[model samples]
Target: MTGDVDVRRIRNSSFLTWVGLVLGSWVGLLWGSLLFMPVGAGFGIAAASAMGGYIAVPLWGTFWGLTGLSGQRNKALRDLGIKVLPDDDPLTQRVGALAARLGLTTRPWVAIMPHNNAFAIGATRNSAMVVLGQPLINTLTDAELDAIIGHELGHIATNDMRRMGLARSFQNALVWYFGFSRTLQRWVRWILTWMSEFLILAMSRRREYWADAVGAALTSKEDMISALEKLHHKPRLSSYERHHARLMIHGVDSSVFSTHPNFLQRKRALEKEKYLRFVKKPVVAEEVLAAPVTLPLVAEMAYVNSK
Candidate 1:
């Protein structure tokens, strides 16, 4: 069953990679032709356009896609204020055990920072590192933390960071190609930017769902859902900010610019019995009604339970 899931995931990733390559190539070609036309007009528009599309665009896109603009290991760690965990640390132990369970031959560097979230970073499987925030560690239980770590491992296993980097490179190429313009070209570029954003965000949301499934596979459906609730309820905001954040949680604002799906939507998806059954887990909704004042009662309950 796990083997089948792995095969399906690999196939999906391959499909997305091909789609990104083709789309990126086309976008680059269009942008390259526009820029090259000014100089290439001496050779005639048709020839210049062909040269830009066939040679310049594909070469540029390929370089960016393969090399990647982000994923600099040192820079990422430094920016996040991440410090490596000692071999004996419990978190490090947990990470090692989890990596072994996931069949990762090259274990990811485990680090911690002073924030409320955890994420994975690396250009490839061999270089992957997982960073957990101090607040996240302090707030979540052992089981909850395991579920969250599973999600980050899922990102590494699925190569989401690399895929997103390639997509971002295409977006950056578009931005650079259009940055010089001021009038109609600038407006066109703005529209294209939004289009690229929508596509990237769509992919990001799907990746999150896939990661959630991986998390469930690693832990339990209940544990994954509880972790999500704990993450949602973790207190890091002021009263006023919390109120506004709640509105955003309900998706009052546009999600076009957001990367992850709304938490409520994610929880609902996890609640589905069909998905739980597929993962060979029994589905049992632990009902926690929302308070009149506070929107998500599960988060409140989770907070109380943790206390």
Candidate 2:
């Protein structure tokens, strides 16, 4: 019975395993080359007055592309009124210790946002930021939050955060390429532009599933599934909560174009594997473990995987 179940679970893992990594990398490379290459080449040609400057355009573009991610992250933080936590707080220590346990080379800035939320984004492994909502601390148990943190760490490990930055860069380059005008040229251009945002977001959603899988493997499948249920069962659009309009763990929108999968799908995906095994010998906080372990954060109390 154990062998049969393990084989079935392994098969499911295979199906979803590499798909997100391949898709994120491919889209990143494709969109980066298509959108930025021309701009880099143009700048290089225009700056041909200086031999070194001409040679530096492509390199410059790559540098700026990554640096530009900071601005986008800042805007998101600003809009949400997220406050950066002082580095010496107990919460920060706990979260950082978990991050270290997870083997994340970069330590993300920890912030408190107003909503029941947490998100990770940065240009490189070193630039990742993990933000948690105050409400999450009040709502979720320690382990639930850990599962959530593990999910975000998974994103950092996979460089999905960097990929998101690259996607945004592609969008910006697309806007520049089209002169930021809706002068509906041909059907082809319209189709391409119309699908650009969708493609970027779709790619993000795919990465979410990968993160979920990783989180389940790190913790127990039961932990991930239970966390989802907790999020989905929250009061309907509670205003006192941190995020209002955003359909996070439990909220809903009239439309189907959600940034994430519905709670049921996520729960099923994580719980359809071994549960008792991991829980029996769960990996906990430590500098090192003999076996691979995942570290999670408090925001995961309700939220996991941002796409």
Query: Which candidate should be chosen as best, given lDDT against the real structure?
Result: 1
TM-score of each model, in listed order: 0.72, 0.61
Local error of candidate 1 at 129, Å? Answer: 0.4
Report residue 4 deviation for candidate 2 (angstroms): 26
lDDT of 2 by residue, 65-150 (tens): 56776565686667767788888987777667666655554567778776665567665667777777677788887777777776
RMSD of each: 12.0, 13.6
Tens-place lDDT per residue, model 1, 44-106, is: 563454453454444555468657524456776666467988878888888877766666667
Best by the TM-score measure = 1
Q: Give candidate 2's error at residue 292 in angstroms.
A: 19
Worst 10 residues of 1 by lDDT: 244-253
